[model samples]
Target: MLPSKTSVTDRSWRAGTAPGALPLLGHVPALWRRPLEFLASLPAHGDLVEVRLGPARAYLAAHPELVRHVLLNPRLFDKGGVFDKARQLLGNSLSVSRGEEHRFQRRLIQPAFHPTRIAAYTTAVAADTRTVTDAWRAGETRDIGDAMHSLLMRVAARTLFSTGLDEATVEEARQCLRTVSHGIYKRTVAPLGIMEKLPTPANRAYDHANARLRQIVADMIAVRRRSDEDHGDLLSTLLRAEHPETGQKLDDGQLLDQVVTFLVAGSETTASTLAFVFHLMGRLPEVEKRVHAEVDAALGGRTPVHEDLPALPYIRNVITETLRLYPPSWMAMRVAAEDVELGGRKVPAGTMILYSPYALHHNPDLFPDPEIFDADRWAGERAAQVPRGALLPFGAGSHKCIGDVLALTETALIVATVAARWRLRPEPGSALRPEPKATLEPGPLPMVLERR
Candidate 1:
C-alpha cells in the first residue's frame, strides 16, 4: 500500500507521501526515470513531501520560502547526505567541512576571490580564451562541450596556480575528474557499501582516478613549495594565508584538499555553464545576434577587460538567463541537526532535506513562461522583482559558491571574446540532452564555427 497525503494542520508531522512508490524501493523508480520532473511535481503532493530512496526517507522542500528558511538556518540543517558521499573523494574541503572548520576555511580562501584580485585575473582570462577561439577556422566543425571544458581547464590552471599544463596532462586530468565526479554521483544515489568495496570495474576505475587526482595535487604542491615565490595568484594566497585568531596555517593534507577543491569545483561548473550558453545561442539566433552586437559594441574587436564587464549588460543577461535555465549545481542536500518545525510540520532530526535550483528556476508561478529562454526578464526592474531565494544559481548563505565572482567574470569575458569574432552553429541532427552527472551538463555539443 502507498502512503497517504496528510493535511498541513494534522500536527502529526507526517508528510504527504508521493504516489507510485513500490513496496521496498519507494519512489526510487520514479526518481530514477525522470529525476528533475519527479522533484518538480512534489509541490502538488504537499509543501513538504516524503520521499523514500531505498530504505531512507527524505523530505523535499517544494516551496521557495521553505527553501529560504532551510538555507538561512544552516546550523539547524547542516551539510550532510550527498556531501558526506562527496567527502569520500573531496576529503575535508570547504564544500564538505562543517561548523567552525568550514568558517575558518572560508576566511582563509576568501581573499583569493576578492573583487580586486578577480579583476587582476581578467587579463589572463581574456588572453586564454582568445588562444582557443583564435584557432577555430570559419568552416571548422567542433565539439563545443569539449572546447569549453578544455578552455576552462587551461584558464583554471593558469589563473589559479599560474601554471601551464601540457595538452596531454590536461586531457588526463579532465578524464580523471570526470571519473571521480561520476563515482561520487553513483555512490550518492545507489549508496551500496559492499559494492564500493568489491573489485568491480566501476569501483576499480574510481579508485585509480582518485589516486591520480591526489598525485596531481601532490606534484603541484611540490612545485609551489620549490619555487617559494609569490606569483600573485590563488596558490600564493592559499600558501601564505593564516587564521586571524589562531595564526595557524593549513598542513599539507589540508592544503591539498583546498587546492583540489578549487581546481575541480572551478573547472567543471564554469565549463558546463559555458557549454550550455553556447548551445542556447545556437538554438536561439535572435539571442545570439543581441549577444554578438553587445560584445562588438562594448569591446570594439579588442579582448574584454574589467571595465568592459559593466558595459555589456546584454551579454550578462544572456549568461544569467542561461544559468536560470540550466544551473550547473542543480541540487543540494542538508541533514536536519535537530527536530525542527518547517512549513508548520515537524521534521524529525536525522532526516535529509533536498532543495533543487533546477526546480526553483522552472517554477511557473515564480517565472512566467518558465520554459522559454528570455534574456529580457533579467533587464532593469524585472531583474530586481525576482524574489529572494527564488534564483539561486550560485546558491545562498554561508555555503554559497566562493567562485561566483571568478565564474561570472570568465563566462562574460569568454562570451564577449568569442561572440565578437564567430557565431557557433549547431550541426544538424546533433543530439543535445541534459545529462545530470555532478553538474547538469549538455553532452557533446557539436557545432560549426562561422566567422562573423
Candidate 2:
C-alpha cells in the first residue's frame, strides 16, 4: 500500500527499494534498460526512495515538494556527482561552482543574460535560423537531430563570441563537444577511477576532444585580447565584467572555463529541444497546423524579428509543452552538506541526492493526461495553475539557467522561422526513441521537409 501523506510525514528515516533491485547492482540494470520509465515508476515505492548505484547508496526525491526543498537550500544540497565530472570539461565555471564562488560567478555572468542584452541577440538568432532552413531542399530526408545541433552551434558561436570563430573552427568545436558529451553519462554513473584511466577507445576520444576544446577556447581568447576591441557579445561582456564585491575580473584560465561552460550548456540543451519540437510537429498534425497558421499570421512570410515574439503566443506554448514532455536536463545530482530532514525523514550529511525532471513532469496528479501533447494547456489560466517546481526545464532556484531568456528567445524565433517555411513529416519506418545522455535527446529523428 502507498504510504499516506500524514503517515509519511510522521515516520522516521527509512529506505524503500524499487521492484527489480539485485545484489550489488541494485536498480542499475532497470535504470539502464529504460531510465525515464524506471524513474517515473519510482514514486510508487516512496517519496524518498533508496537508489543504489553499484553499492553507492543515493536518495531519489520522487515528490515535487521534496525536490523544491532540496533545490532552494543549496547550502544543504550542493552540486556534486555529474557536475564534478563536468568540471573535467567546464572547469570551475558557474554551472559547477558552489557557495561563494558560485555567487560571485553568477554576479559576473548575470548581465550577459539581461532582458535588453538578450533582445539584442534576436537578429543574430534569426539570421542563423535562416542560414540553416534556407539550405534545406524540399522532399529531402534530413536528420533533424543533426541539423538542429549544427544550426544551434552556429547560433551559439555567433551570439556568444560574435564573429570570433570561422566556419572551420565552429565545425571543429562542434565535433569536439559531441565527442566529449558521448561519455559523460557513463562517467557520471559509474565513476570508476581506475576504469576511466584505462586506455580504452572511449577514453582516448574523450582526451582528444578535451584537448581540442581547450585549444579552441584559448585561441578565441587570445585573438580577442590582441584585438582589444569590444564587440558587444557575451565574451566581451565577460572580459569587461568585474566582481561586485571584490572588483576582481576573470583571468585568462577562468575566461576559458566560462567559455567552455557556455558552449556545452547552451548549445546542447537548445538543440535537443528544437529537435524534439520538430519531431513532435511531424507526429501531431493538428499541432503542426496551428503552428503554421500562427507563424504565417505573425510573420507574414517575412523573416522573424525580436518584436514578433509577443504576437506568436501559440509558438511559445508549443515550446513549453515540448519542454514538459522532453526536458533536456533530464536528471540532476547533488550531495548533502549536512544532516537534514527531507520529506520528514532524516538525511545524513554526505548523502547523494538524485532528482529527475522527467519523472516530476510526468506525474499524473500534477498534470492530467500527462502523456498527451497539449500546447493549449499552457494558454490562459491553465498555465497559472501549474505547481511550483513541477516544470523545471531550465531548473529552479539560484542555479536556474542564467541564459534562459536567451534560450527562449532563440527557440521562439527558430520555431516561427521554420514553421513559416516548411512542414516536417516523419520518414517511413522511423521510430522516435529517447536517448538519455547527459541531456535527454531524441535519437535518430529523420524527417522529410515539405516547403509550405
Candidate 3:
C-alpha cells in the first residue's frame, strides 16, 4: 500500500527514497554534484521520487504517463517558480505566460513558427550550412561544438532575427547569451539574488552580459522600427504584429524580451541538437551510412528543397534518436496551482514537480536498450512500439516547442549538407561528456573532418 500523508513526515518525502539528508542543507550539494546519476538512480525507489532542495520539496516524475498528464493538463499545473526566473530573461513572452495570457501570446507568436514560414528559410539554412561546411579543411581537426555554435548562431541571426548580422556581432551576442544563460541556471539551482544585487565578479559579469544582450535586441528592434519596409523576418513580424482581439501590439520592453527569447531558444537548442547528432553520427557508422543513403536518395544529386523534408524519413529518425539521448532542455519544472493526483499520488497545491526529458528518454522500459543510440527505434514501424507522450524532446501538449518543425528542418538540412561534403571522425583520445548548462553543451568535440 502507498504511504499516507499522516504516515510520512513533512520534512522528508515518503513515496521515494532519498540518499539520506544532511542536517539542514538537504540534498543540494549531491544534486549539484551529480544531477544525471542522481536522477538515473531514482527508479530504484518509485516512479515519483522525492528529493529535497534546501527547504523546498520537489518531486521527479519518471513515469511517462504521469509526465504526460502533468504537461498536457497545463490548467492544473502551471509553469511556476523556475518559469518566473525564465521570465527574468523572457519577460512576458510566450514561454513564461500561463492560462489566457499564454494562449494569447501563443496565438500571436504562432504564425512566425508555422511550417510555411520556417520552410521559407530553407534556402538560407542550406546556404549558411554550406558556407560553414565548405570552410572545414579535410585533414585538419576542429571542435565540432564550436563549429556548430558559430554556424547555428549565423543561421539564427539570418532566419530568426532577420538581422543579416556579421560573424563578429553574432559572436558577441553568443558570448553574452552564454554568460546570461549560465548565470540563470546557476541561480536557479542555488538561489543567488542577493549575490546578484552585490557587485561581485560573477554577478557583475552576468549583469553586464545581460545588459549588452538586451541592448543588442533593442538596437535591432529600433532599426526595424525605423525601416519603412517589412523584411518578413521574426523581428519585423513581431514589431508589426497586431493582437487579433485588441489589435494592441507588444511594447518595446515586451518586444525586446521576445527577441531575446527567440535568440536564446532558437539558437542554443538547435545547436545542441546538431552537436549531439554529429557526435552520435561519428560514434555510430551504420547510422551515419543509413542517414547519408536516405538523404542522397531523397535529393537524387539535387540540392534539397524545403518540400523534400516530408519524404526524408531517415533524417527525421536520426534527429529523434539524438533527441532521445541528449535533449537540449534536459529537465523542466512546473508547480501545481491546485491539489492534484498524479500517478496515484496526492500532490498538494503549489507542490513543485520536475519532469526530466533526459530521464524519460532513458527509461529502459519505454525505450528498450535506451542508451544504444539507434535511429531505427524511431522508424514508422518501430516508433509505434513506444507509448504516446514517451518521446518528449519538444515537450507535450499546448506548451510543446513552437520551433519543433523548424528545428527538425534545420538539423536535417545541416546534417545532410555536412554528410554530402565531409565525414567527421571522433578524436581517439578525446573525452566528450554532456556538460549541460542552460542547454546541453558537449564542449571541445575534437574531430577530424574528411571530405566526402
Candidate 4:
C-alpha cells in the first residue's frame, strides 16, 4: 500500500518502494532496449522510482524542482561515481573532479573556449565547411552524419590540440572515441570491477579502443612539450597553463587526461548537433526559409564573420530547439553521498540517481505540442511562459557544458554557410530516426545536397 505523508519513515520515504526487477540482469535489458521510454514511464508511477541493478538500486527523479535542487546544491552532490568510470577514458580532467580541484582545472581550461577565443576559430570552421561542401556535385547523394562528423573532426583538430596532429592521427582518435563511448555505457552497466575481467566481444573492443585513445593523446602531449613555438589550440593552453593560486602546471599524466577529456567531450556532441539541424531543416520549410533569409540579410553575400553571431536570433533559436529535443548528454547520473531528503522524501546514501533531459523536455505541461519542431517558441512572448531551467539543452547550474558558446557558434556558422549554398533533402524513402548513444543523432543520415 502507498503510505501517507507523515506515516512514511525517512528510509521508506527515500526508497519510495519500486517494482521488482527481472532475475540476475535486473533492468539492464530495459535500459539497453529503450532508455528514454523507460525514463518517461517512471513519472506515471511516482515522483521518484527505484530500479534494481545487479545488486544496488538506481533512483530516478522526474520532477523539475528536484532536478533544480540536485543541480544547484553541488555541496550535497558531486559528479563522482558514474563520472569516475568515465574518467577511466577521460582522465582526471574537468568532467570528473570536484571542489577546489575541479575549480582550479576549470579555471585553467576556461580561456580557450571563451567567446573571444571561440570567435577566433570561426575562420577555421568556415574554411573546413567550405572544403567539405565544395566537393559535393549537384544532386549527389551524401551521408550527412558522415559529413558533419568530418567537419567536426576538422574543427577539433584545429581548435583542440596545440601540436596539430596530422589528419591520419586525428582519424585514429575519432575511431577510438566511438569505441570508448560505447564502452563506457557497457562497462558501467556491467557488475562493478568485472568489466576489465570479462572476455566478451564488447569488452575486447573497449580495451583496444581505450589503449589507442591513450596512446594518441600521450603522443600529442609529448609533441606539445617539445615545441618552442606557441599555437593557440586548447592543448597548448593546458601545457602552458599554471594554476593561479598554486602557480604549478599540470604534469604529463594530467595533461594527457585533459586532452582525452577534450576529444571525447567536444567532438561527438558538436557533430551530433549539426546532424540534427540538417534533419530539422529538411522537415520544417518555414523555419528553413526564415533561417536562410536571416543569413542572407546578415551576410549580404559576404561570408559569416564572428561579429555577426549576436545579431542572429533565429539561428540561435534553431540550435537551442534542437538541443531541447535532442540533448547531447541525454541522461545525467549521480550516486547519493549521504542519506538525504529531496521533495519531502528521504533518500538513503549510495543510491544512484538519474535525470533524463529528454523526458523533461517532452513534458506536455511545460512545452505544449512538445514533439513539434518550433523555433518561434523562443522568439517573443512565448518564451516567457517557460520556466528558467525548463529550456536546458546544455544543462543547468555548475555542471552545465563549458563549451556551449563554442558549440552554438559553430552550429550557426556551419549551418548558415551550408544552407545558403545548398538545399538538403532526405534521400527518398529514408526515415530520420533518433539513434541514442551519448547524444541523439540521425544514424547514417543520407541526404542529397543540390546546388542553390
Q: What's the C-alpha lDDT at position 52 in model 3?
A: 86
C-alpha root-mean-square deviation, each candidate? 4.6, 3.4, 4.5, 4.6
Tens digits of per-residue lDDT, candidate 3, 242-359, equal 7878887888888888878777777778888898888888888998898778777887665666777777888888889889888888888888899886655788999989888888
Best by lDDT: 2
Native-vs-model 4 lDDT? 0.75
Q: What is the lDDT of residue 98 in candidate 4?
A: 79
Candidate 2: tens digits of C-alpha lDDT, residues 164-257: 7888989999999988666655676665657778999989998899789889889888888887788888888888888777898989999998
Which candidate order results from sorting by TM-score in descending order?
Answer: 2, 1, 3, 4
Candidate 4 deviant stretches above 4 angstroms:
1-29, 44-46, 49-56, 192-205
Q: Among all windows of ten consecutive residues in candidate 1, which has the lowest summed lDDT?
A: 1-10
Q: Against the correct fold, how does model 2 do in TM-score?
A: 0.94
> Which has the better lDDT: candidate 1, or candidate 2?
2
Ranking by lDDT: 2, 1, 3, 4
The residue ranges of model 1 lying beyond 4 angstroms of the native Cα positions read 1-17
